[model samples]
Target: MGLDAFAAACCAIPVLASLLAVRFAYVLCRSGLPPTRPRAAGLRCLIVLGSGGHTAEMMNIITELQKDRFTPRYYVAALTDSMSLQKAQVYEKSLIQGEGEKIIKNAQFMQIYRSREVGQSYITSIATTLLAVLHALWLIIRIRPQVIFCNGPGTCIPLCASAFLLKVLGLGWSSIFYIESIARVKKLSLSGLLLYKLRISDQFFVQWTQLQQKYPRAQYAGRLM
Candidate 1:
């Protein structure tokens, strides 16, 4: 209320912010995922899982891969209409509003959805995952991607399943990364998960310590940005 009080409060703000950031980082680092071994071969095609913000990140990676040597095409396994799905990607003409925002994207892919009216994320994720399985299977038969990389937005289960099946026969991507969105900090709700097996890929990425511990076979080794 007074000048001295105001000055003290202002001084504490930075300290509070620093403390929060430290806690966030600790949560991330403490997350326990299985150690991932790097692949011995070069990457080829890619299969992306989910949509929204995380999907965009995978697309950015695909664009970079295309420019280099990998012939990258993506199968987007998530909820979206074909047209709106097109809009979901970052365009070359997209101008960013701030420094950290991405403005350009490149990756041609297909989308498989759960539902638009569904409000329960758990159910929706399972449905999307199953749909993604069918879609990815079809793509694998056709394009036969060398690698299937999933950028997570809860639709990782099916894509990875498809890849695992492909790998069983020795015809799929060598590494799979489940890049966590800021929203994927989930507590364990189910006892034995029917989904979230995540056993296919050579690498798995997550930002939550709880999930990291739950799935002790995944690698908590990287960030998306």
Candidate 2:
């Protein structure tokens, strides 16, 4: 109410936030996943695809997952990124042809607004991120994916954040796996940094062993591409 009281309250905000963050980190780290069990067919997955290099790396990760394991895969990217969507479709088609009818049932695509356009202003980027969050939240609610996968890119941030919020709210139990870009051998990209610091990702994968050592929790699972 008074100046001194108000100042003290404001000062306490950061401390409260820090304490909350520590608790969150503890819960996330201690909440290790349940033991692996034999799963029947049809595990839903949601994969976020960024453009160009990001898309390629994500595709490689999906390929390594083995088409038989994850079923009903949903690929999401920027609405304008037709190239990435098309590429995903083609890959899905190949799986359908190679694996027969099963793979066809699992492949789907959804698009969200781009978090930032080329050379967009910070204000515009923020607006776009809000829109992306709304879209991501809607998709997560409707699809209720078992696991969500993404690699480093600005576009993936909103979706990953949305997934984290869902987890916090106990609305979804979707595991989030974030793989740092292969290009980021020494340090994480901005997006990767945010996800890691926020402790939103259940598993973080790095291509290089050095990064794994740097971020001890991150798994070094070889090169994505």
Candidate 3:
């Protein structure tokens, strides 16, 4: 009787895992649909900012966002990226000036550790990457944002992965939108490639028509910058 129960449990494990995987895949497939209207409280949004040009382009895109709908915005950047945070703060300040105290109360900024620094040894990067992912998971759980917006940034990889995990576990449903950098005319950035190949992003956009042709899943939005 004990041997039979053990065998049954072993068989059940794989079956349960397979069902979870199927459910997760269905969720991913359905993610592309337009989200329903938010509650009267509004939707929480998480925006991941990269360094330099990446930040500039993202700011441009976000500037057009309806501040009232995507309320309680959370801006995330790399721990080492003070400049990007500063830029985001500046943008928030502009919002405050235009929209008043409500905008000030609705904005939040956060920083996450980078997975792998440039020139870091790959051996060491593995450990650092794991740490980053763990930190990202904690942040995602804490925020539980309804929408996640990011462009070409390595910093976003961990956050998006954490959000996807939450979705699979039936913990949260953070819609992830990945926009390729405007500079990537011929190919997707490494970060973009990973998200694209993994199908982790609910919506993927590219500026170049060539990239759209090459990646049918990516929508061509023209030069956003």
What Cα-based lDDT does every candidate model obtain? Answer: 0.53, 0.82, 0.91
Give the best candidate by TM-score: 3
lDDT tens per residue, model 3, 78-197: 999999988888888876555653447788999999999989999999999999999999999999989999998899999999999998988998989999999999999999999999
Q: What is the C-alpha RMSD of each candidate to the true structure, in Å?
A: 21.0, 5.3, 2.3
What TM-score would each prediction reach against the true structure? Answer: 0.53, 0.82, 0.92
Tens digits of per-residue lDDT, candidate 1, 1-225, equal 699999999999999888766754543443233325553454455656444565566666554544333444455655553533464344422433453655333345566544333475776666755665687577566666655566554455555566556655445433455455545566431211323452344555666677678777644644545
On a 0 to 1 TM-score scale, where does candidate 2 land against the true structure?
0.82
Task: Report the C-alpha displacement of residue 183, candidate 3, in angstroms.
Answer: 0.4
Model 3, clash count?
A: 0
- Winner on TM-score between 1 and 3 is 3
Instruction: Report how far residue 61 has shifted in candidate 3, in Å.
Output: 0.8
The order by descending lDDT is 3, 2, 1
The prediction achieving the highest lDDT against the true structure is 3
Task: Compute the lDDT for candidate 3.
Answer: 0.91
Please give, for residues 1-225, the per-residue lDDT of candidate 2 as tens digits: 599999999999999888777766654864447526767876789898988899999998888786667878999988888899888888887865456545476788888888788889998788877787788788888888877889986777777777777666567667788989899989999999998887888888999999999999898889768
Worst 10 residues of 1 by lDDT: 187-196
